[model samples]
Structures are given as structure tokens and as C-alpha cells.
Target: MSFINYATREIQLKIVYYGCGLCGKTTNLQVIHEMLADESKGKLTSLATNQDRTLFFDFMPLVAEAIKGFSTKFQMYTVPGQVMYNLTRRLVLKGVDGVVFTADSQWDKMEENVESFNNLIENLSLQGDSIDKVPYVIQYNKMDLPSVAPVNYLEFLLNNRGVRHPSIIASAKTGEGVLETLNLVTRLVLNNFIKTQTGRSPAEKKNLVLM
Candidate 1:
């Protein structure tokens, strides 16, 4: 659920970046943090462990109309993708309005990607949210690297669900598809939020369009 502050006139939406270890989640955040305008973003913060790290920050992305005079704010997070950090990942997902599942495109990392994705669905269920209900997007990251799997194979592995999500292909290290991923998820979040807060649902997209 997004937090709405009438006094400050802001609606804060939380979006989490999830993926397998070293699958470019952190790299996505770093590139996005650097890309945002100073006036639009907050300080990037990181909590690190010997093997993994968690990152988060807030930014005002005025990509949508205000809700009852409240501006839109985004609080983004990246959980440690290693299996040992499952607890931390679930904790970060609490009250999340949107998700970005960043999959490593490398052939060798495919198994880890599937495991992390299932872990995601399990954690979401434990928290009373299902991927089918929650708005999310997929990012096939590290596309610039060699030995990457075909998009169709990766989709069959993860996004083959009855309700498929929008997916992007890119190299986060080079800032490709990063903003588009964020924008898509946030749009879904906003539409979902609007539908929840109001009685009507927003118009749906035409097809499984990749942003």
C-alpha cells in the first residue's frame, strides 16, 4: 500500500528490485540513482553484509497526475539476492506497491534466476500478496554480455504465467532499459493504486508490451 500524506501532499510508492545474486539489481539502482536529477531524488543508502547488500532510496518521479493534490514519490529498494538473505528480501517487500524482477541473462545464471523467482512468489504469498495481484515488471538484464540466453527461453522459464508481465532487455551497467523498467512498474502501481483508492479501474494496455 502506498502512503498518502495530506499535510505534505505526497503519495509515496514503494518499488523493490528483486533478482538472483550478482544479477544486476544493485547495478540498476546505481545507474538510476546517478541518472535522476538532483532536485528529484533523495540520498541513496546501502546496508551491506560480507556477501550481499541491500539498497534503497526515495525520489519524486512526477510521471503521473497528482492524486487529490498530492505529488507522487517513489521509494525504491533492492534486496540481497542470495538465498541466505531470504529473510531480508521478504522484509523489504512489506508494503511494496510494485516490483522489478531483474533476471540475469547469462546462461550460467539461469538456475539461480528460477530459484530466486520462485522465492519471490513464495515470499509474496507469505505476506498476503500474490504476483498475480501485485503489479510488477521483468528486466532481462546484462543483454550486452555474451552467452546470454534467448528471450523466449527466459520467458518460458519465468514469465510464462497466465498473466504475463511487461519485460525489457538491457545492460544495467550501461543504463539501458533501467528507466523504462521503473516507469512501467510505477505506471502499473499508479493504475492499481487508483483502482484501489477509487471505484474504477484504469484502462488496460493493449497487449504484452515491453517498455
Candidate 2:
């Protein structure tokens, strides 16, 4: 659900990054935070363990494009990638307007990728929300790794949801495909919001691509 502040003419939406530990969820945010202008983005805050892996979430708020005279602000977050932090993950997923599923591309991480994706679906269902109903994108991260699996195999493992989502191949360390993934998901979130507010058919939604 979006938070609309009528007095301020602002709309706040949440977008979460989810995946197994070391899948580059944190990398995505860190890269994005570095790329964004200080005027456009808020503090990039994270709660992590001594080793620096995400323990709770990474949160950053940014002002995006406007919608119908309302300022569009996005609350970006990343849930802890550890399976033991499922409770924290569920809490971060509450009222998410969009999601970015960052899958580790290394062949050895395939199983964890699939498991984490399933965890995402289960967590969403526990909140009375379905994956089909949410705006999300898949990011095959760590593509620069020599041991990475092929994109097709990775797609089969994570995107077999019957409804294919926009997926990106990225090397978070290299800053490749990070913003593209973000832009696509934000576009989906904005389109979903517009559709619900105006009752527009999928095809009728405007193509408002974010840079």
C-alpha cells in the first residue's frame, strides 16, 4: 500500500531487495546510494553484524518523479539475507509496493537462490499477499563470476512462476544492471499504482520509464 500525504502532496512507496546472503542485495543498495545525488536520496542506513552482512535491513528514501501533482518518494529497503532472519524479512516486507529479487549467479548458489525465492512467496502468503499480485523483478547478480550459471538455467530456477517478470543480469560489484533493475521495478510499481487508482487495463497504463 502507498502512503499518500495529501497535505504535502507526496506519495511514499516501498521497494524491497530480497535474496540469500552474499547475493548482492546490499551491494545493489550501496552502489545505488553512491550513484544518486545527495539531493535525491536520503541516508543509506543498514543494521548488520560485525562481519557487515545485512542483519535487519538497509533503508534509503529517495524522491522520484511526481504523479498527478503529488511528489513520488520511494522507501528502498533490503531484508537480511540469512534464513534465520525470516522474521525480520517478513517484517520488512510489510506493505511493500515493489520488490527486487537478487539471485546469486554462481552455480553453487543456485539452490540457495531457489530456496530464498520460495521463502519470499511463503512470507508474502503469510501476509495475505500473493506473488502474482505484487510488482517485482528478478536480478541475476554476480554475473561477472566465472562460475556463474547460464541465464536460462537461472531463469528456470527462479522465474517459473508462470508469470515471467522483468529480469536483469548484473554484476553488483561492477555497478552493472543495478539501476536498470531499480528502474524496471519502479516502473512496475508506478504502473500498478496508476492501474489501481484509475482502473486502467494493463495495456492502458502509460509507459513511464524511470531513468
Candidate 3:
């Protein structure tokens, strides 16, 4: 859910990057933080272990186009991908406006990906949200790897559901498809917000896209 502050003319949205351990979730945030200008983004903060694995989450706030004349600020977060951190993952997902599921494309990580995805569904259910209703995107990360699963296979495994979402082929380390993934998810979230605020479809709100 997005928080609108009328007094300050600001709107805040939370977007969480989720996936199994070593699926490049942190890498995605790192790439995005590097690509954004300092003036447009806040510090990239991470709680990681000695081995540099995410211990809890990585957070970075980014300023994007305004909505309804209010500045839109997106707080991007990456949850700890380790299976044992499931509780931390659910906590981070408490008020998510959007999500980007980063899947490890390596063939051997398929089981991990499936388990993480199932965990995501269960966690959302616990939070009183439905996976079908969330504005989300899937990212098949590490596309540059030689022994990765085919895009079709990944899609079939992850998105064979009632509503398939926008999916991207990404190499977070190389910055391939990273911005596109963010842009699409941001757009999806903004469209949903616009619909809720204006009681009209996004296409009917041309001014919403203008800023």
C-alpha cells in the first residue's frame, strides 16, 4: 500500500525484491543504486553477514515522477534470501506496494526458486494479501550465465498461474534489464494507485503519466 501525505505533498511506495539465496536480489539493488544519481536516491543500506550475505534486508529510497503534484518516493528493499530468514522476509513484506521476484536462472537452483516462490505466496497470505492481486514482476536474473534455464522454461515454472505478470531477463551484475524491470513495476504500482485514487483506469488519467 502507498502512503499519501497531503500535508507534505509526498507519496511513498514500498517495493520489495524477493528470491532464493544467491539469486542476485542484492545485486539488483546494487545495480539500481549505482545507476541512480545521488541527488535522486538515498544511501543504500544493507544488513549483511561477514560473508556479505544479506542478514535481513537492503534498503534504498529513490525519487521518481510525481503523482497528483506530490513527489513520489519509492523505498526499494531486498529481503534476506536464505530459507531460514522466512520470518524476516514476511516482516519486510508487511506493506509492499509492488514486488520483483528475482529467480536464479541456473538449472540447479530451480528447486530453490520454487520453494522461495511458494514461501512468498504463504507469507502474503499471512499478511492478508493475495499473490493474484499484487502488482508484481518476475526477473529471471543471471541471464549471462552459460548453464541457465531457458526463458520459456523459467516462465512456465514460475508464472503458470491465473494471471501471468511481466517478466524480464536480467543480468544484475552487468545491469542488463535492471532499469526496465524497475520501470515496469513502478508503472504497474502507479497505475494501481491512480485507479484507486481517481476511480478511473490509468489510461484515462493522462496527467498521471505526465509526471
lDDT of 1 by residue, 1-211 (tens): 8888889777888889889988988888788888877776677667765554543322224323445577888887888887887887888899989999999999999999999999999999999999898999999999999999999999999898998889999899999999899778888888899888865565533232423
Number of clashing pairs, model 2? Answer: 0
Give the lDDT of residue 144 in candidate 1.
Answer: 94
RMSD of 3: 2.6
39-81, model 3: which lDDT tens digit per residue? 8899999999999999989999999765658899999999999
lDDT of each: 0.83, 0.92, 0.93
Q: If scored against the real structure, what TM-score would every candidate get?
A: 0.89, 0.95, 0.95
Cα RMSDs, all models? 4.8, 3.3, 2.6
Off by over 4 Å in 1: 50-68, 204-211
What is the alpha-carbon RMSD of candidate 1 to the true structure?
Answer: 4.8
Worst 10 residues of 2 by lDDT: 202-211
* Clash totals, every prediction: 0, 0, 0
